[model samples]
Target: MIPPRSNRSQPLACNILRYRDLNRIERMFNRLKLFRRIATRYDKMAKSFLGFLHLTAAKLWLPGFVKRG
Candidate 1:
């Protein structure tokens, strides 16, 4: 799969895809879509949208690393 690029011109090619990575990314997007704000593009600015996206991603990622007692 093509990876993210700093500029919007075009994405660069990447190494071979792993099934596990693809699965995780798909799941992440599915979870992201569950948030109406994110799915509907409510943020008018790209920066704000990206900030919220990063916030959402961080929330999703936390459970994996945090341990419960």
Candidate 2:
């Protein structure tokens, strides 16, 4: 079946603020890539990588919260 189209015939919604922030976002992402594991992602296990991502997020959002190995 064919998908529906808008009666207004307008283009898809977009965020001008988000588009303007793309450069800054890219810079932040590049800076965040300094961590070796995050950049390479060598962990073969999904759980391990997920744990790594969670830990990274925790560290970023909750400053000074250290994850004990």
- Model 2 scores a TM of 0.49
lDDT of 1 at 50: 100
Predicted candidate 2 versus true structure: per-residue lDDT over 1-69, tens digit per residue = 222355747656766677668867787667557768978987889999889877876676575575757
TM-score, model 1 to reference: 0.67
TM-scores of the models, in the order given = 0.67, 0.49
Best by TM-score: 1
Instruction: State the lDDT at 14 in candidate 1.
Output: 65
Residue-level lDDT of model 1, residues 8-55, one tens digit each, is 687666654665589788998999999899999999999999999999
Pairs that collide, model 1: none
- Residue 7, candidate 2: Cα error in Å is 36
lDDT for each candidate structure: 0.87, 0.70
